[model samples]
Target: MEVFVEPQEGSPFCIRIGCSDTVLEIKAKIEKHRGIPVYRQTLVFDNETLDDELDVEGCNILDGSRVWLIVAPEPPQSAKIELCVGTLPSVMRLPIEVQVNDPVKRLREVVRSLEDVSLERVKLYADGTELEDGRRICDYELQDNSSVDVRIKPPKFMVMVLPWKADLKVAVEVKQLDKVKVLRKELEKLQPSLELDLPSEGYFFIHNQSGMDEDKSFQWHGVEMGDTIEVFRGTISR
Candidate 1:
């Protein structure tokens, strides 16, 4: 008689076997057809998991009967490690369990899942060094109970714009990914009354007392919240 094996993820397939065939024998036939290991395959009939030692007839499995096949995922090769993740300046730390071989990117994903934050904006650090996504946890020599820092990247932040000749300072809001050119435009829009010709007057932006690249983003220049961006009456050649 033929029994239908319906996998959790894919279409069902037929497996021809005798009624006296044991569940283990049926699983062997499935492995031959599906290439799924017998140990990883769980067969369910009539909402009950079938025992490997029981015969198909004893389990009341007849021809055209549908048997649900659940394939288990591969087990982790390495032992699980516990790490404490805490946000900056926050005393509360959350314990996260992960495989030692798991990548730093996976750690960030775990944090994002538990916290109310986006995965792309999540940053993880260990031992004063920022973790790279492609590198594994073992690469950082992170041991069990090691503390990891989680910082959420802010979408928008404020920056102080200081004019070179004038003592007046204007606060402008900008995104972390905004380029220096965008910042200049934002400044112009915020104070339209000011007679500032950033483009025509050859005006440029400065950060940390150094001229900033107009094409570079605020994140590239490491501009933080309330950081001063000095405006000078000059143009950058490059």
Candidate 2:
């Protein structure tokens, strides 16, 4: 089968190979034909990353299917890297090219200029890990063409979750980004005896004096660090 290979910054090429050929084999072919090193190549098919162990058929790559081969800039010794930045539910990514030795503060400045958000508000996460402002990009082990999650920090306030029926009040800290579903799952782990009947419709957040409101986010309903919210399962019928 013949497949189209599109590099990040080069002309697309076609390679002839068998259906059972592994991605590593294809990378080797690319290295031999195009003089691109296999270590610096990051392959993507149908918007998903292709692993070295996966064969052509396993990736659902058919004949004439175009695969992305994101190659690092040459000079082999250069510390340049291409970074992708975006939020969730959106595959769109803004490409950022910078040196690996560059401090995160400089990168944050660039992001702030491009995104029009304050440097303090923008946070970059890569590989499920948050990037620290004091460290260099290389210190985080970010290679060429890496994906980074760019999120603007919203106003955060802590809230305490307490059992509504019981007198027990555990002052557990809560963040604004905490989801109701995730909290319920954690609560279930902490207290297996309590039958938390959280409904699919939504859960309720009730303050001692404020009463009940089915607000999705804790911050939306004016929940603060010292404020204690009673946990009550939603009574919606399935």
Q: Which model scores highest in lDDT?
A: 1
Query: Please, what are the lDDT tens digits per residue for candidate 2 over residues 1-238?
Result: 8889998786899998789999878888898889976656778999998877799989999999999998855433456999987875478998899987677888888888887867788888888777767556875668777898878776435456776566666555457646544555566665645654434555555666554434355566666666877776565332
lDDT (10s digit) by residue, model 1, range 1-238 = 9989999998999989998899888988998998986657789999999977799889999899999999976445677889999998797898899897777899898898887788888999887788877556765667889999988887558898886676778788888888888986777676567754455567888899888998999999999999999888867776
Which pairs of residues clash in candidate 2, taking residues 3 or more apart in a chain or in different chains?
none
C-alpha TM-scores of all predictions? 0.38, 0.35
Q: How many pairs of residues collide in each model?
A: 0, 0
Off by over 4 Å in 1: 1-76, 156-173, 176-238
Distance from true location, Cα of 88 in model 2, Å? 2.9
Least accurate 10 contiguous residues by lDDT in model 2? 195-204
By TM-score, who's the top model here?
A: 1
Q: How well does candidate 2 score on lDDT at residue 92? A: 93
lDDT of 2 at 113: 89
Residue ranges of candidate 2 with Cα displaced over 4 Å: 1-78, 155-238
